[model samples]
Target: MTAAAPAPRTPRRRGRPSRTQTETGPATRDRILEAAREEFSERGYEKTSVRGIAKTAGVDSALVHHYFGTKEQVFEAAIEVAFAPALDAPAALEEGPLDGVGERLTRFILGIWENPATRTPLLAIVRSAVNNETAAAVFRRLVAAQLLRRIAGALDVPDGELRAELAAAQLVGIAMLRYVIKVEPLASADPEQIVRRVAPVVQAHLTGH
Candidate 1:
Protein backbone atom coordinates (compact mmCIF):
# COMPACT_ATOMS: atom_id res chain seq x y z
CA MET A 1 0.00 0.00 0.00
CA THR A 2 1.16 3.54 -0.65
CA ALA A 3 0.54 4.83 2.80
CA ALA A 4 1.45 2.68 5.77
CA ALA A 5 -1.00 2.67 8.63
CA PRO A 6 0.13 5.09 11.34
CA ALA A 7 1.52 3.28 14.36
CA PRO A 8 -0.98 3.16 17.15
CA ARG A 9 -0.28 5.79 19.81
CA THR A 10 0.89 4.33 23.12
CA PRO A 11 -1.08 5.21 26.18
CA ARG A 12 1.07 6.75 28.92
CA ARG A 13 1.31 4.75 32.05
CA ARG A 14 0.38 6.65 35.20
CA GLY A 15 2.47 6.39 38.35
CA ARG A 16 0.87 4.88 41.42
CA PRO A 17 -0.39 7.53 43.83
CA SER A 18 0.94 7.50 47.39
CA ARG A 19 -1.37 6.44 50.17
CA THR A 20 0.37 8.68 52.67
CA GLN A 21 0.80 11.52 50.26
CA THR A 22 0.97 15.13 51.51
CA GLU A 23 -2.77 15.38 50.94
CA THR A 24 -3.05 12.45 53.31
CA GLY A 25 -1.21 11.57 56.53
CA PRO A 26 0.52 14.66 57.95
CA ALA A 27 -0.84 17.03 55.37
CA THR A 28 -4.37 15.79 55.84
CA ARG A 29 -3.88 15.98 59.55
CA ASP A 30 -2.62 19.53 59.22
CA ARG A 31 -5.49 20.49 56.97
CA ILE A 32 -7.94 19.08 59.47
CA LEU A 33 -6.19 20.86 62.29
CA GLU A 34 -6.15 24.16 60.43
CA ALA A 35 -9.82 23.83 59.58
CA ALA A 36 -10.60 22.81 63.13
CA ARG A 37 -8.64 25.82 64.30
CA GLU A 38 -10.67 28.20 62.16
CA GLU A 39 -13.91 26.61 63.26
CA PHE A 40 -12.94 26.67 66.90
CA SER A 41 -11.73 30.23 66.66
CA GLU A 42 -15.00 31.38 65.18
CA ARG A 43 -17.42 29.06 67.00
CA GLY A 44 -15.62 28.07 70.22
CA TYR A 45 -15.62 24.57 71.71
CA GLU A 46 -19.37 23.98 72.10
CA LYS A 47 -20.37 25.05 68.60
CA THR A 48 -17.47 23.66 66.54
CA SER A 49 -18.11 20.17 65.19
CA VAL A 50 -16.02 17.47 63.52
CA ARG A 51 -18.34 17.56 60.55
CA GLY A 52 -17.64 21.24 60.12
CA ILE A 53 -13.89 20.68 60.08
CA ALA A 54 -14.25 17.70 57.78
CA LYS A 55 -16.29 19.80 55.35
CA THR A 56 -13.76 22.59 55.59
CA ALA A 57 -10.87 20.18 54.98
CA GLY A 58 -12.71 18.53 52.09
CA VAL A 59 -12.48 15.07 53.67
CA ASP A 60 -14.91 12.53 55.04
CA SER A 61 -16.13 13.31 58.54
CA ALA A 62 -15.03 9.82 59.52
CA LEU A 63 -11.52 10.54 58.35
CA VAL A 64 -11.27 13.35 60.89
CA HIS A 65 -12.45 10.94 63.54
CA HIS A 66 -10.03 8.32 62.29
CA TYR A 67 -7.10 10.68 62.69
CA PHE A 68 -8.28 12.56 65.79
CA GLY A 69 -10.89 10.28 67.42
CA THR A 70 -13.27 13.00 68.62
CA LYS A 71 -13.90 16.71 68.44
CA GLU A 72 -12.06 17.04 71.76
CA GLN A 73 -9.12 15.11 70.37
CA VAL A 74 -9.10 17.30 67.26
CA PHE A 75 -9.13 20.35 69.50
CA GLU A 76 -6.27 18.85 71.48
CA ALA A 77 -4.29 18.19 68.32
CA ALA A 78 -4.87 21.72 67.08
CA ILE A 79 -3.69 23.07 70.41
CA GLU A 80 -0.62 20.85 70.22
CA VAL A 81 0.10 22.06 66.70
CA ALA A 82 0.32 25.60 68.05
CA PHE A 83 3.14 24.60 70.35
CA ALA A 84 4.92 22.01 68.21
CA PRO A 85 7.36 24.54 66.81
CA ALA A 86 8.59 25.58 70.24
CA LEU A 87 9.00 21.98 71.38
CA ASP A 88 12.13 21.73 69.29
CA ALA A 89 14.07 23.90 71.75
CA PRO A 90 15.00 21.13 74.18
CA ALA A 91 16.83 19.35 71.40
CA ALA A 92 19.05 22.36 70.99
CA LEU A 93 20.37 21.69 74.50
CA GLU A 94 20.49 17.91 74.11
CA GLU A 95 23.96 17.90 72.57
CA GLY A 96 25.44 20.97 74.20
CA PRO A 97 26.15 22.53 77.57
CA LEU A 98 23.07 23.51 79.57
CA ASP A 99 24.52 26.85 80.62
CA GLY A 100 22.94 28.96 77.91
CA VAL A 101 20.12 26.63 77.18
CA GLY A 102 17.67 28.96 78.84
CA GLU A 103 18.51 31.79 76.47
CA ARG A 104 18.10 29.61 73.43
CA LEU A 105 14.87 28.17 74.75
CA THR A 106 13.49 31.56 75.64
CA ARG A 107 14.38 32.95 72.26
CA PHE A 108 12.75 30.04 70.54
CA ILE A 109 9.53 30.20 72.54
CA LEU A 110 9.17 33.96 72.19
CA GLY A 111 10.07 33.82 68.54
CA ILE A 112 7.10 31.58 67.84
CA TRP A 113 4.72 33.99 69.57
CA GLU A 114 6.30 36.84 67.64
CA ASN A 115 6.02 35.06 64.34
CA PRO A 116 2.78 35.84 62.51
CA ALA A 117 2.78 32.33 61.03
CA THR A 118 2.50 30.78 64.50
CA ARG A 119 1.00 33.54 66.63
CA THR A 120 -2.62 33.43 65.41
CA PRO A 121 -3.07 29.75 66.16
CA LEU A 122 -1.43 30.21 69.54
CA LEU A 123 -3.75 33.09 70.33
CA ALA A 124 -6.76 30.98 69.44
CA ILE A 125 -5.73 28.33 71.94
CA VAL A 126 -4.91 30.95 74.52
CA ARG A 127 -8.33 32.51 74.17
CA SER A 128 -10.04 29.17 74.33
CA ALA A 129 -8.04 28.07 77.36
CA VAL A 130 -8.93 31.18 79.26
CA ASN A 131 -12.67 30.72 78.87
CA ASN A 132 -13.02 26.95 78.90
CA GLU A 133 -11.78 24.63 81.62
CA THR A 134 -11.85 21.78 79.11
CA ALA A 135 -9.69 23.81 76.79
CA ALA A 136 -7.40 24.64 79.71
CA ALA A 137 -7.05 20.97 80.57
CA VAL A 138 -6.27 20.21 76.95
CA PHE A 139 -3.64 22.94 77.05
CA ARG A 140 -2.11 21.46 80.21
CA ARG A 141 -2.07 18.00 78.71
CA LEU A 142 -0.46 19.23 75.53
CA VAL A 143 2.27 21.05 77.44
CA ALA A 144 2.85 18.06 79.69
CA ALA A 145 2.72 15.43 77.00
CA GLN A 146 4.24 17.26 74.06
CA LEU A 147 6.61 19.75 75.62
CA LEU A 148 7.31 19.65 79.37
CA ARG A 149 7.87 15.89 79.64
CA ARG A 150 10.47 15.93 76.91
CA ILE A 151 12.06 19.09 78.25
CA ALA A 152 12.39 17.58 81.73
CA GLY A 153 14.08 14.50 80.37
CA ALA A 154 16.49 16.50 78.27
CA LEU A 155 17.45 18.81 81.12
CA ASP A 156 20.25 17.90 83.51
CA VAL A 157 19.14 19.09 86.91
CA PRO A 158 17.68 18.07 90.25
CA ASP A 159 13.90 17.80 90.32
CA GLY A 160 13.92 17.98 86.60
CA GLU A 161 10.24 17.25 86.43
CA LEU A 162 9.22 19.99 88.82
CA ARG A 163 11.84 22.31 87.38
CA ALA A 164 10.60 21.85 83.87
CA GLU A 165 7.03 22.52 84.95
CA LEU A 166 8.08 25.70 86.70
CA ALA A 167 10.16 26.80 83.74
CA ALA A 168 7.15 26.20 81.55
CA ALA A 169 5.00 28.28 83.81
CA GLN A 170 7.47 31.13 83.68
CA LEU A 171 7.72 31.11 79.90
CA VAL A 172 4.00 30.66 79.51
CA GLY A 173 3.39 33.61 81.79
CA ILE A 174 5.59 35.75 79.59
CA ALA A 175 3.70 34.58 76.53
CA MET A 176 0.39 35.49 78.14
CA LEU A 177 1.53 38.95 79.08
CA ARG A 178 3.41 39.93 75.96
CA TYR A 179 1.38 38.35 73.24
CA VAL A 180 -1.96 37.23 74.54
CA ILE A 181 -2.67 40.10 76.90
CA LYS A 182 -0.69 42.69 74.98
CA VAL A 183 0.89 44.20 78.09
CA GLU A 184 2.93 47.32 77.67
CA PRO A 185 6.74 47.42 77.86
CA LEU A 186 6.96 43.64 77.93
CA ALA A 187 4.98 43.54 74.71
CA SER A 188 6.83 46.45 73.16
CA ALA A 189 10.29 45.56 74.35
CA ASP A 190 12.73 44.08 71.86
CA PRO A 191 12.85 40.31 71.61
CA GLU A 192 16.52 40.19 72.59
CA GLN A 193 15.91 42.17 75.74
CA ILE A 194 12.96 40.05 76.71
CA VAL A 195 14.95 36.89 76.15
CA ARG A 196 17.97 38.20 78.04
CA ARG A 197 15.90 39.23 81.01
CA VAL A 198 13.68 36.20 81.10
CA ALA A 199 16.27 33.54 80.22
CA PRO A 200 18.17 33.87 83.48
CA VAL A 201 14.94 33.44 85.42
CA VAL A 202 14.09 30.28 83.48
CA GLN A 203 17.69 29.08 83.89
CA ALA A 204 17.53 29.55 87.62
CA HIS A 205 14.18 27.80 87.72
CA LEU A 206 15.55 24.86 85.79
CA THR A 207 18.80 24.75 87.77
CA GLY A 208 17.06 25.16 91.13
CA HIS A 209 18.75 28.30 92.28
Candidate 2:
Protein backbone atom coordinates (compact mmCIF):
# COMPACT_ATOMS: atom_id res chain seq x y z
CA MET A 1 0.00 0.00 0.00
CA THR A 2 1.16 3.58 -0.71
CA ALA A 3 2.12 5.68 2.40
CA ALA A 4 -0.49 8.31 3.38
CA ALA A 5 0.54 11.93 3.94
CA PRO A 6 1.09 12.79 7.63
CA ALA A 7 -1.34 15.26 9.31
CA PRO A 8 0.15 18.70 10.09
CA ARG A 9 1.18 19.38 13.65
CA THR A 10 -0.46 22.17 15.67
CA PRO A 11 1.81 24.68 17.42
CA ARG A 12 1.55 25.16 21.18
CA ARG A 13 1.19 28.59 22.80
CA ARG A 14 4.42 30.08 24.25
CA GLY A 15 3.33 30.64 27.88
CA ARG A 16 3.62 28.03 30.63
CA PRO A 17 0.50 25.93 31.01
CA SER A 18 -1.63 26.33 34.12
CA ARG A 19 -0.75 24.05 37.03
CA THR A 20 -4.37 22.95 37.52
CA GLN A 21 -6.93 22.15 34.84
CA THR A 22 -9.54 24.22 36.67
CA GLU A 23 -7.17 27.23 36.71
CA THR A 24 -7.91 27.88 33.07
CA GLY A 25 -10.35 30.78 33.38
CA PRO A 26 -12.64 33.03 35.42
CA ALA A 27 -15.49 30.69 34.53
CA THR A 28 -14.03 28.00 36.78
CA ARG A 29 -13.54 30.48 39.61
CA ASP A 30 -17.12 31.63 39.27
CA ARG A 31 -18.29 28.04 39.15
CA ILE A 32 -16.46 27.31 42.37
CA LEU A 33 -17.99 30.39 43.98
CA GLU A 34 -21.51 29.45 42.92
CA ALA A 35 -21.01 25.96 44.24
CA ALA A 36 -19.67 27.38 47.48
CA ARG A 37 -22.77 29.54 47.86
CA GLU A 38 -25.09 26.61 47.30
CA GLU A 39 -23.12 24.48 49.71
CA PHE A 40 -23.04 27.20 52.34
CA SER A 41 -26.74 27.90 51.88
CA GLU A 42 -27.73 24.27 52.24
CA ARG A 43 -25.26 23.25 54.94
CA GLY A 44 -24.80 26.52 56.78
CA TYR A 45 -21.28 27.91 57.31
CA GLU A 46 -20.57 25.58 60.21
CA LYS A 47 -21.08 22.44 58.16
CA THR A 48 -19.88 23.52 54.70
CA SER A 49 -16.41 22.49 53.65
CA VAL A 50 -13.93 23.13 50.86
CA ARG A 51 -14.23 19.50 49.83
CA GLY A 52 -17.99 19.75 49.63
CA ILE A 53 -17.77 22.90 47.55
CA ALA A 54 -15.20 21.28 45.27
CA LYS A 55 -17.40 18.22 44.85
CA THR A 56 -20.39 20.38 44.03
CA ALA A 57 -18.30 22.39 41.57
CA GLY A 58 -16.86 19.24 40.01
CA VAL A 59 -13.35 20.38 40.85
CA ASP A 60 -10.63 19.03 43.10
CA SER A 61 -10.48 20.32 46.66
CA ALA A 62 -6.98 21.55 45.86
CA LEU A 63 -8.48 23.59 43.03
CA VAL A 64 -10.95 25.14 45.42
CA HIS A 65 -8.05 25.95 47.76
CA HIS A 66 -6.08 27.29 44.84
CA TYR A 67 -8.92 29.61 43.89
CA PHE A 68 -10.20 30.65 47.33
CA GLY A 69 -7.70 29.40 49.94
CA THR A 70 -10.20 28.15 52.55
CA LYS A 71 -13.85 27.61 53.35
CA GLU A 72 -14.04 31.01 55.08
CA GLN A 73 -12.45 32.66 52.08
CA VAL A 74 -14.85 30.86 49.77
CA PHE A 75 -17.75 31.94 51.93
CA GLU A 76 -16.49 35.53 51.87
CA ALA A 77 -16.25 35.49 48.09
CA ALA A 78 -19.74 34.01 47.77
CA ILE A 79 -21.19 36.64 50.08
CA GLU A 80 -19.39 39.31 48.10
CA VAL A 81 -21.12 38.12 44.95
CA ALA A 82 -24.53 37.81 46.60
CA PHE A 83 -24.26 41.22 48.27
CA ALA A 84 -22.86 42.92 45.18
CA PRO A 85 -26.17 44.49 44.20
CA ALA A 86 -26.92 45.99 47.58
CA LEU A 87 -23.41 47.51 47.74
CA ASP A 88 -24.84 50.22 45.51
CA ALA A 89 -26.66 51.57 48.56
CA PRO A 90 -24.00 54.27 48.86
CA ALA A 91 -24.85 55.50 45.39
CA ALA A 92 -28.52 55.75 46.26
CA LEU A 93 -27.56 57.82 49.30
CA GLU A 94 -25.60 60.25 47.14
CA GLU A 95 -28.01 60.36 44.19
CA GLY A 96 -30.23 63.14 45.48
CA PRO A 97 -30.98 65.63 48.22
CA LEU A 98 -29.68 64.56 51.63
CA ASP A 99 -33.13 65.26 53.03
CA GLY A 100 -34.62 62.42 51.00
CA VAL A 101 -31.67 60.06 51.45
CA GLY A 102 -33.58 57.77 53.79
CA GLU A 103 -36.51 57.18 51.48
CA ARG A 104 -34.27 56.74 48.50
CA LEU A 105 -32.06 54.24 50.33
CA THR A 106 -35.04 52.42 51.80
CA ARG A 107 -36.75 52.18 48.43
CA PHE A 108 -33.58 51.14 46.69
CA ILE A 109 -32.80 48.41 49.25
CA LEU A 110 -36.35 47.05 49.41
CA GLY A 111 -36.52 47.08 45.62
CA ILE A 112 -33.59 44.67 45.54
CA TRP A 113 -35.22 42.22 47.96
CA GLU A 114 -38.52 42.52 46.09
CA ASN A 115 -36.97 41.50 42.80
CA PRO A 116 -36.95 37.72 42.45
CA ALA A 117 -33.77 37.96 40.42
CA THR A 118 -31.73 39.22 43.39
CA ARG A 119 -33.60 37.80 46.37
CA THR A 120 -32.66 34.13 46.15
CA PRO A 121 -28.91 34.42 46.63
CA LEU A 122 -29.38 37.23 49.13
CA LEU A 123 -31.64 34.97 51.16
CA ALA A 124 -28.92 32.35 51.19
CA ILE A 125 -26.30 34.77 52.47
CA VAL A 126 -28.64 36.20 55.08
CA ARG A 127 -29.56 32.79 56.45
CA SER A 128 -25.94 31.72 56.64
CA ALA A 129 -25.04 35.00 58.35
CA VAL A 130 -27.81 34.82 60.95
CA ASN A 131 -26.87 31.27 61.93
CA ASN A 132 -23.08 31.40 61.93
CA GLU A 133 -20.74 33.90 63.57
CA THR A 134 -17.95 33.24 61.09
CA ALA A 135 -20.32 33.84 58.21
CA ALA A 136 -21.66 36.91 60.00
CA ALA A 137 -18.14 38.31 60.25
CA VAL A 138 -17.61 37.94 56.55
CA PHE A 139 -20.94 39.62 55.82
CA ARG A 140 -20.25 42.40 58.32
CA ARG A 141 -16.74 43.09 57.05
CA LEU A 142 -17.92 43.53 53.48
CA VAL A 143 -20.98 45.57 54.39
CA ALA A 144 -19.04 47.72 56.81
CA ALA A 145 -16.16 48.22 54.41
CA GLN A 146 -17.86 48.49 51.04
CA LEU A 147 -21.37 49.62 51.93
CA LEU A 148 -21.65 51.36 55.30
CA ARG A 149 -18.32 53.15 55.32
CA ARG A 150 -18.97 54.63 51.90
CA ILE A 151 -22.37 55.84 53.02
CA ALA A 152 -20.86 57.25 56.18
CA GLY A 153 -18.19 59.12 54.22
CA ALA A 154 -20.89 60.79 52.17
CA LEU A 155 -22.52 62.33 55.25
CA ASP A 156 -19.37 63.82 56.92
CA VAL A 157 -20.89 63.54 60.38
CA PRO A 158 -18.91 62.54 63.48
CA ASP A 159 -21.34 59.70 64.00
CA GLY A 160 -21.69 58.93 60.31
CA GLU A 161 -20.67 55.32 60.71
CA LEU A 162 -23.11 54.83 63.55
CA ARG A 163 -25.89 56.46 61.57
CA ALA A 164 -25.10 54.33 58.58
CA GLU A 165 -25.26 51.27 60.79
CA LEU A 166 -28.58 52.41 62.23
CA ALA A 167 -29.99 52.87 58.76
CA ALA A 168 -28.70 49.41 57.99
CA ALA A 169 -30.40 48.09 61.12
CA GLN A 170 -33.71 49.57 60.02
CA LEU A 171 -33.41 48.20 56.48
CA VAL A 172 -32.12 44.83 57.66
CA GLY A 173 -34.96 44.50 60.16
CA ILE A 174 -37.46 45.07 57.37
CA ALA A 175 -35.71 42.50 55.21
CA MET A 176 -35.70 39.97 58.05
CA LEU A 177 -39.36 40.45 58.85
CA ARG A 178 -40.69 40.69 55.32
CA TYR A 179 -38.42 38.35 53.44
CA VAL A 180 -36.52 36.05 55.80
CA ILE A 181 -38.95 35.52 58.66
CA LYS A 182 -42.08 36.33 56.60
CA VAL A 183 -43.93 38.05 59.42
CA GLU A 184 -47.48 39.39 59.11
CA PRO A 185 -48.76 42.58 57.41
CA LEU A 186 -45.25 43.86 56.83
CA ALA A 187 -44.57 40.92 54.58
CA SER A 188 -47.80 41.32 52.60
CA ALA A 189 -48.00 45.11 52.68
CA ASP A 190 -47.75 47.10 49.46
CA PRO A 191 -44.22 47.96 48.48
CA GLU A 192 -45.17 51.61 48.26
CA GLN A 193 -46.70 51.56 51.72
CA ILE A 194 -43.65 49.90 53.21
CA VAL A 195 -41.46 52.42 51.43
CA ARG A 196 -43.52 55.29 52.80
CA ARG A 197 -43.48 53.98 56.35
CA VAL A 198 -39.92 52.70 56.54
CA ALA A 199 -38.23 55.46 54.58
CA PRO A 200 -38.98 57.98 57.31
CA VAL A 201 -37.31 55.81 59.92
CA VAL A 202 -34.31 55.21 57.69
CA GLN A 203 -34.22 58.92 56.87
CA ALA A 204 -34.17 59.84 60.52
CA HIS A 205 -31.19 57.54 61.04
CA LEU A 206 -29.16 58.95 58.15
CA THR A 207 -30.01 62.65 58.44
CA GLY A 208 -30.91 62.90 62.13
CA HIS A 209 -34.11 64.79 61.26
Candidate 3:
Protein backbone atom coordinates (compact mmCIF):
# COMPACT_ATOMS: atom_id res chain seq x y z
CA MET A 1 0.00 0.00 0.00
CA THR A 2 1.04 3.59 -0.67
CA ALA A 3 2.42 5.48 2.39
CA ALA A 4 -0.15 7.84 3.85
CA ALA A 5 0.81 11.53 4.17
CA PRO A 6 1.72 12.49 7.75
CA ALA A 7 -0.64 14.77 9.59
CA PRO A 8 0.53 18.37 9.95
CA ARG A 9 2.49 19.26 13.07
CA THR A 10 1.97 22.77 14.48
CA PRO A 11 5.06 24.35 15.91
CA ARG A 12 4.86 25.07 19.63
CA ARG A 13 5.30 28.59 21.03
CA ARG A 14 8.83 29.51 22.23
CA GLY A 15 7.84 29.15 25.84
CA ARG A 16 5.06 27.05 27.46
CA PRO A 17 1.82 28.86 28.02
CA SER A 18 1.10 29.46 31.68
CA ARG A 19 0.71 26.20 33.55
CA THR A 20 -1.54 27.97 36.00
CA GLN A 21 -5.06 26.63 35.98
CA THR A 22 -6.47 29.74 37.61
CA GLU A 23 -7.17 32.53 35.14
CA THR A 24 -6.45 35.36 37.56
CA GLY A 25 -4.10 35.32 40.51
CA PRO A 26 -5.71 38.19 42.38
CA ALA A 27 -9.19 36.82 41.98
CA THR A 28 -8.10 33.37 43.11
CA ARG A 29 -6.29 34.88 46.06
CA ASP A 30 -9.41 36.77 47.02
CA ARG A 31 -11.52 33.62 46.78
CA ILE A 32 -9.04 31.82 48.98
CA LEU A 33 -9.16 34.66 51.47
CA GLU A 34 -12.95 34.75 51.53
CA ALA A 35 -13.07 31.01 51.99
CA ALA A 36 -10.58 31.25 54.79
CA ARG A 37 -12.73 33.88 56.45
CA GLU A 38 -15.81 31.72 56.29
CA GLU A 39 -14.01 28.66 57.56
CA PHE A 40 -12.31 30.53 60.35
CA SER A 41 -15.53 32.19 61.36
CA GLU A 42 -17.53 29.00 61.32
CA ARG A 43 -14.89 26.72 62.80
CA GLY A 44 -12.86 29.04 65.00
CA TYR A 45 -9.09 29.44 64.69
CA GLU A 46 -7.92 26.37 66.57
CA LYS A 47 -10.20 24.07 64.62
CA THR A 48 -9.67 25.70 61.24
CA SER A 49 -6.56 24.32 59.61
CA VAL A 50 -4.76 25.36 56.45
CA ARG A 51 -6.03 22.23 54.75
CA GLY A 52 -9.57 23.14 55.67
CA ILE A 53 -9.16 26.60 54.22
CA ALA A 54 -7.72 25.21 51.03
CA LYS A 55 -10.50 22.66 50.73
CA THR A 56 -13.03 25.42 51.15
CA ALA A 57 -11.24 27.45 48.48
CA GLY A 58 -11.16 24.42 46.12
CA VAL A 59 -7.45 24.73 45.79
CA ASP A 60 -4.45 22.75 46.95
CA SER A 61 -3.30 23.25 50.54
CA ALA A 62 0.11 24.24 49.25
CA LEU A 63 -1.41 27.18 47.47
CA VAL A 64 -2.43 28.62 50.78
CA HIS A 65 1.14 28.45 51.94
CA HIS A 66 2.31 29.76 48.58
CA TYR A 67 0.11 32.81 48.89
CA PHE A 68 0.28 33.22 52.65
CA GLY A 69 3.21 31.69 54.48
CA THR A 70 1.40 30.46 57.58
CA LYS A 71 -2.00 30.08 59.22
CA GLU A 72 -1.32 33.28 61.13
CA GLN A 73 -0.56 35.06 57.87
CA VAL A 74 -3.76 33.78 56.33
CA PHE A 75 -5.75 34.97 59.36
CA GLU A 76 -4.11 38.38 59.21
CA ALA A 77 -4.84 38.72 55.51
CA ALA A 78 -8.42 37.65 56.08
CA ILE A 79 -8.81 40.23 58.84
CA GLU A 80 -7.42 42.95 56.59
CA VAL A 81 -9.84 41.98 53.83
CA ALA A 82 -12.71 42.00 56.30
CA PHE A 83 -11.83 45.44 57.64
CA ALA A 84 -10.52 47.14 54.51
CA PRO A 85 -13.11 49.91 54.66
CA ALA A 86 -12.49 50.73 58.29
CA LEU A 87 -8.75 50.35 57.80
CA ASP A 88 -8.90 52.79 54.91
CA ALA A 89 -11.26 55.28 56.55
CA PRO A 90 -8.53 57.22 58.32
CA ALA A 91 -6.89 58.06 55.03
CA ALA A 92 -10.26 58.94 53.61
CA LEU A 93 -10.88 61.22 56.61
CA GLU A 94 -7.70 63.13 55.83
CA GLU A 95 -9.32 64.31 52.61
CA GLY A 96 -12.18 65.91 54.55
CA PRO A 97 -12.62 67.98 57.69
CA LEU A 98 -11.19 66.25 60.75
CA ASP A 99 -13.91 67.59 63.04
CA GLY A 100 -16.20 64.65 62.35
CA VAL A 101 -13.56 61.96 62.43
CA GLY A 102 -14.99 60.28 65.49
CA GLU A 103 -18.52 60.16 64.10
CA ARG A 104 -17.26 58.87 60.80
CA LEU A 105 -15.12 56.18 62.42
CA THR A 106 -17.97 55.11 64.68
CA ARG A 107 -20.35 54.85 61.76
CA PHE A 108 -17.80 52.98 59.73
CA ILE A 109 -17.18 50.34 62.41
CA LEU A 110 -20.86 49.82 63.17
CA GLY A 111 -21.67 49.72 59.50
CA ILE A 112 -19.19 46.88 59.01
CA TRP A 113 -20.74 44.64 61.65
CA GLU A 114 -24.33 45.56 60.81
CA ASN A 115 -23.75 44.47 57.23
CA PRO A 116 -23.76 40.68 56.81
CA ALA A 117 -20.85 40.93 54.41
CA THR A 118 -18.47 41.95 57.18
CA ARG A 119 -20.28 40.58 60.18
CA THR A 120 -19.27 36.99 59.49
CA PRO A 121 -15.58 37.73 59.42
CA LEU A 122 -15.82 40.05 62.38
CA LEU A 123 -17.54 37.32 64.30
CA ALA A 124 -14.77 34.92 63.41
CA ILE A 125 -12.19 37.38 64.64
CA VAL A 126 -14.06 37.88 67.88
CA ARG A 127 -14.42 34.17 68.39
CA SER A 128 -10.76 33.65 67.71
CA ALA A 129 -9.77 36.47 70.06
CA VAL A 130 -11.82 35.05 72.87
CA ASN A 131 -10.60 31.51 72.36
CA ASN A 132 -6.94 32.01 71.53
CA GLU A 133 -4.33 34.47 72.72
CA THR A 134 -2.36 33.95 69.53
CA ALA A 135 -5.45 34.82 67.56
CA ALA A 136 -5.90 37.94 69.67
CA ALA A 137 -2.34 38.98 68.90
CA VAL A 138 -3.06 38.58 65.22
CA PHE A 139 -6.22 40.66 65.60
CA ARG A 140 -4.41 43.33 67.60
CA ARG A 141 -1.56 43.57 65.13
CA LEU A 142 -3.90 44.03 62.20
CA VAL A 143 -6.08 46.64 63.94
CA ALA A 144 -3.16 48.49 65.46
CA ALA A 145 -1.17 48.52 62.26
CA GLN A 146 -3.94 49.19 59.78
CA LEU A 147 -6.59 51.19 61.66
CA LEU A 148 -5.35 52.59 64.96
CA ARG A 149 -1.88 53.67 63.96
CA ARG A 150 -3.04 55.58 60.94
CA ILE A 151 -5.84 57.24 62.88
CA ALA A 152 -3.44 58.16 65.62
CA GLY A 153 -1.03 59.60 63.08
CA ALA A 154 -3.80 61.75 61.63
CA LEU A 155 -4.28 63.53 64.95
CA ASP A 156 -1.35 65.28 66.58
CA VAL A 157 -1.76 64.69 70.29
CA PRO A 158 0.01 63.32 73.30
CA ASP A 159 -0.51 59.63 74.00
CA GLY A 160 -1.95 59.09 70.57
CA GLU A 161 -0.77 55.50 70.67
CA LEU A 162 -2.49 54.86 73.96
CA ARG A 163 -5.62 56.61 72.81
CA ALA A 164 -5.71 54.59 69.64
CA GLU A 165 -5.20 51.31 71.49
CA LEU A 166 -7.86 52.22 74.04
CA ALA A 167 -10.32 53.19 71.35
CA ALA A 168 -9.72 49.92 69.53
CA ALA A 169 -10.01 47.96 72.77
CA GLN A 170 -13.38 49.52 73.53
CA LEU A 171 -14.79 48.87 70.09
CA VAL A 172 -13.42 45.35 69.81
CA GLY A 173 -14.38 44.49 73.36
CA ILE A 174 -17.92 45.67 72.78
CA ALA A 175 -18.13 43.68 69.57
CA MET A 176 -16.77 40.57 71.26
CA LEU A 177 -19.03 40.79 74.28
CA ARG A 178 -22.23 41.71 72.52
CA TYR A 179 -21.99 40.00 69.18
CA VAL A 180 -19.60 37.10 69.71
CA ILE A 181 -20.36 36.39 73.31
CA LYS A 182 -24.04 37.34 72.94
CA VAL A 183 -24.13 39.61 75.96
CA GLU A 184 -27.71 40.60 76.84
CA PRO A 185 -29.20 44.00 76.04
CA LEU A 186 -26.11 44.92 74.05
CA ALA A 187 -26.69 41.99 71.74
CA SER A 188 -30.37 42.75 71.27
CA ALA A 189 -29.89 46.52 71.00
CA ASP A 190 -30.22 48.15 67.62
CA PRO A 191 -26.87 48.81 65.95
CA GLU A 192 -27.69 52.48 65.38
CA GLN A 193 -28.59 52.94 69.03
CA ILE A 194 -25.35 51.30 70.02
CA VAL A 195 -23.45 53.56 67.68
CA ARG A 196 -25.02 56.68 69.12
CA ARG A 197 -24.17 55.58 72.66
CA VAL A 198 -20.74 54.14 72.00
CA ALA A 199 -19.47 56.53 69.37
CA PRO A 200 -19.20 59.33 71.88
CA VAL A 201 -17.21 57.08 74.18
CA VAL A 202 -14.84 56.13 71.36
CA GLN A 203 -14.70 59.79 70.33
CA ALA A 204 -13.62 60.72 73.79
CA HIS A 205 -10.82 58.22 73.54
CA LEU A 206 -9.79 59.44 70.12
CA THR A 207 -10.26 63.21 70.57
CA GLY A 208 -10.32 63.80 74.30
CA HIS A 209 -14.03 64.66 74.37
Best by lDDT: 2
C-alpha lDDT of all candidate models, in order: 0.81, 0.87, 0.79
Better of 1 and 3 by lDDT: 1
lDDT of 2: 0.87
Give one digit per residue, the lDDT tens place, for model 2 in 78-113. Answer: 889988999888887788888999888989999999
lDDT of 1 by residue, 1-209 (tens): 59998999766334322333334667887888889989888777777888899899988787787788877889988877667887787786575678877777787788888899888888888888888888889988887877888888888567888998888789889999988788998889999989888999988887755
> Stretches of candidate 1 above 4 Å error?
1-30, 59-63
Local accuracy of candidate 3 as per-residue lDDT tens digits, 129-161? 779988989987887787778888987678988
Report the Cα lDDT for residue 94, model 2: 81
Q: lDDT, candidate 2, residue 116?
A: 88
Model 3 CA lDDT for position 47: 95
Candidate 2 residue spans exceeding 4 A from truth: 1-23
Per-prediction TM-score, please?
Answer: 0.79, 0.88, 0.79
TM-score of 1: 0.79
Worst 10 residues of 2 by lDDT: 11-20
Instruction: State model 3's lDDT.
Output: 0.79
